[model samples]
Target: MRANKYEEVWTRIMFEKIEVLSNKTAITRTEMKQGVITLVKGLNAYFNKEISAQNDAEYINKVWNNFHLCEITMNLIGSLTPKELMEIFPIEKIYDGKKYQTKDWFSAHEAVQQLAQETPISESKEVFDFLWDYHNWDLHIFTVNVIASMNNINKMEKGRGLLEQFLEEQGVRTINKMDMIDVNWEEERDGE
Candidate 1:
């Protein structure tokens, strides 16, 4: 899958695979819950030290947005059937100056109606499915193998591609379930 640049190939692969899965499952309540838990856990594990009690909510919300796409992905994996998945994932919470309410993730009719709205929608559910499935803990056994390989690498960026290749070679394509960890720094200090 060569391209004009390395990023193009990676992005294409990410988007195409995700789009297929997104079409399969739109969004539901259960998936939304799973996405929220995933976001909390991921932030806790990845950026725990950076957040304090005083700003936990704000930090978590920021992190959540960063992984909003991830939540969509997680929902796809947790709920296999689109219909079932839709029941699992909820529309995002929206606030209008005062109160907050859940918005619909699969608003086919409203989507059309709001097509010209100021805020454009990009099929996030699709992108989310890819990231979530790619890191699924149940179905993707290669996730285990990749975690083991992490022990030998100095940084995630340096090890991520190799781990993916190794897992692919071992016949692991979907990351439906897995978990593991290795020693890493609390932060990356530039010029180190």
Candidate 2:
């Protein structure tokens, strides 16, 4: 199918607006912006072709999921290290960990290429909430991985101590459980 120049231009602008609001990478903002633009162009092209032939739920879901992944990946790309990318993005270790530094953020440009052939997407608020969940999930995964990575499984406290030290060294604040309880905790929860 041929491209729609007008639609492409409009879609590009919409992606840019989303990036401004949802992208969190301070150091890699420009790179992220370029990445988002590329996604917009490529997705627009693919969807134009695919939409003409079919509109199956499976196909739609794939496109939708791919879109969500693209957004999440871009938002986290800066801090998603080479190692993390290879491992399907292991949760970032914030404290007692070496992976959460803002500078560690690098582009997941490769994923962009892969996802271009693929897609789900939703509201801006939904995207923000998805990212927030992923962030907290990463921290939880980091803690477990830290303990598991230890040579001696019996020495759990040692692993905990190491993580504690790492957390202290890095300025990533640990979210407290008690301080998280509120009227709208369930409605609009942050990290815990």
Give the TM-scores of the predictions, in the order they appear.
0.20, 0.22
Model 1 residue runs over 4 Å out of place are: 1-6, 13-63, 81-192
Q: Residue by residue across 4-56, what tens digits does model 1's lDDT show?
A: 34434443454554455457556564544454344333333332223233575
What's the lDDT for residue 164 in model 2? Answer: 45
Each prediction's whole-model lDDT (CA): 0.38, 0.40
In model 2, state the lDDT of residue 35.
48
lDDT per residue, candidate 2, 134-184, as tens digits?
433433333233233332222233433444456546754444312322367
Q: For model 2, state the Cα shift of residue 53 in Å.
A: 11
- The alpha-carbon deviation from the true structure for residue 178 of candidate 2, after best TM-score superposition, in angstroms, is 54
Give the poorly placed runs of model 2, Cα more than 4 Å off: 1-27, 51-192
Q: Against the correct fold, how does model 1 do in TM-score?
A: 0.20
